[model samples]
Target: MLKIISNQDFDTFAQNAKDAPRKRSHHNLHEQLDAGVQRLFISTEPETYMRPHRHSEEHKWELFLVLKGQLDLLIFDDEGNVTERHSLSPETNRAIEIPPGTWHGYACMQSGTVGLEIKEGAYIPTPQEDFAPWSPAEGEDGANDYRDWMSTAQPNTK
Candidate 1:
């Protein structure tokens, strides 16, 4: 079977994200395709907190593309220091390629924000070595603190 994803597809995903408990939703476009590489669209609201994590395995690489709305992508160093933060929107700085073994996270900056995520897959759980120990897990109080900083964080400021 052939699957074609259009703007309407993303619209529905974004709508679902609004009411999603985790403040986000995903529409997989990879199942019908090959297994090694996975592609999907993730829709999120401003409240979403994407915990900082990295792929310790050398083969794993992550890519993000803003399909609509806005996002603040934050990159951290090995010791959990803020190294880079970039504001991205569909009209500008739409795509980012994250290398393996890099700690990173993002915050949705708009009501209905949708982004395309692509990576090497077989869908393994997050390893303890890969997940950042300094950052709070999803839904934790500290996570909200991170989210708040994300809302106001600039490119090079604290």
Candidate 2:
């Protein structure tokens, strides 16, 4: 049976901030047809900031498509050094395919920037991702520190 799952329907199944730990919502374990692709819909309220980090394996890529608002995509290196920064607006409707082994993060520029994330996935139990040591854990105060640093930090690459 073929069924169409709208973003609204997906949101019903996703985990909101109060339901989970993060500021946005996510829906994992989608239909089997979505295998190898981790689908997510991020809410834009509260103006969340993702800390710079990378996937553990260097073989997969994560694509972030802004479905609604603006985002500042920040790329960094192994030592938590910023490499590139991009200001993305909704007019382009393009997705940023972030390669593996690259540290990256994002900040919502508007009030309702919802992003759609597609990634290669065969969810693992441990070491699923490599987070920059300079950042904080999901619930730590370090998150605030990380955001402050991202605002004034300079790019590290050409």
CA-lDDT, candidates in order: 0.84, 0.66
- Candidate of highest lDDT: 1
lDDT string, candidate 1, 26-142, tens digits? 888877554788888899998888888998889889999997999888888777778898878977899999999888889888988988999998778787777788888887778
- Cα TM-score per model: 0.91, 0.74
Cα deviation at 93, candidate 1, in Å, is 0.6
Candidate 2, residue 146: lDDT: 68
Error of 2 at 124 (Å): 2.9
Q: Candidate 2: misplaced stretches above 4 Å?
A: 1-21, 32-34, 125-129, 151-154
Model 1 pairs whose backbones collide: none
User: For candidate 2, lDDT tens digit of each residue in 20-124?
Assistant: 445566554356543777676666443355767787687668888876667778887776778788876668645788887777888655655567777887655
